[model samples]
Target: MSYVDGFLLPVPKKNLAAYKKMAAKAGKIWREHGALDYRECAGDDLKTAFGLPYPKLMKLKKGEVPVFSWIMFKSRKHRDTVNAKVMKDPRIQAMCPDPKQMPFDVKRMCYGGFKTLVKA
Candidate 1:
């Protein structure tokens, strides 16, 4: 089964473009290091009729927006290997010397590893 890493964070509303640019660069690096796929999505239509929405999930604050992201790998071992390389890549280090300085609130970001249950 495939493995995945998910991330949900709060980015400042005005930093959307900057966040996308950063994600694109990082995604390319992940792909180069063996990630099968990388996706970054900005929240829209936050109001949900039923359960919790991104805004609520990340506890989005004033002037903030939610970004939902994921990275795919063939398996957990592959993910670990790819991530180790990605972390050491000079480009990534230069891009985020201080995670807190990025366009989003790193401290409040949510992240987790998961094993895919189904695909269709």
Candidate 2:
């Protein structure tokens, strides 16, 4: 089974383009460092009647959008190894030129690592 890193964040609509650009670069870096897959999806259908909608789940404010993202690895150890290298990559530094200048509010971002229980 594979390991995964997941992220959920709120980004203002006005910054979506910038955010996408950053994510694309980040995905490339992760891939180069051995990530099996990387995906960053913007919220299109945020409302639902049966459960907590993404907007609500993220406590999104007016004009802010929700983004759900993930990266896959061969296993937990592989994920750690890849991430360690990725953190030190100059590509990552270039991707995030200034943490203080990031597109969205870092305080609102939620992230975690997971051990996949099942895969199809």
**Which residue runs of candidate 1 sit more than 4 Å off their true CA positions?**
none
Give the Cα error of residue 116 in candidate 1, in Å: 0.4
Candidate lDDT (C-alpha), each = 0.92, 0.92
TM per candidate comes to: 0.96, 0.95
Q: Which stretches of candidate 2 lie over 4 Å from their true place?
A: none
The residue pairs in collision within model 2 are: none
| Collision pairs in model 1 | none
Model 2 lDDT on a 0 to 1 scale: 0.92
Task: Evaluate residue 57 in candidate 1 and report its C-alpha lDDT on the 0 to 100 scale.
Answer: 70
The Cα RMSD of model 1 versus the native structure comes to 0.9
The count of residue-pair clashes in candidate 2 stands at 0
Worst 10 residues of 1 by lDDT: 51-60
lDDT of 1 at 29: 99
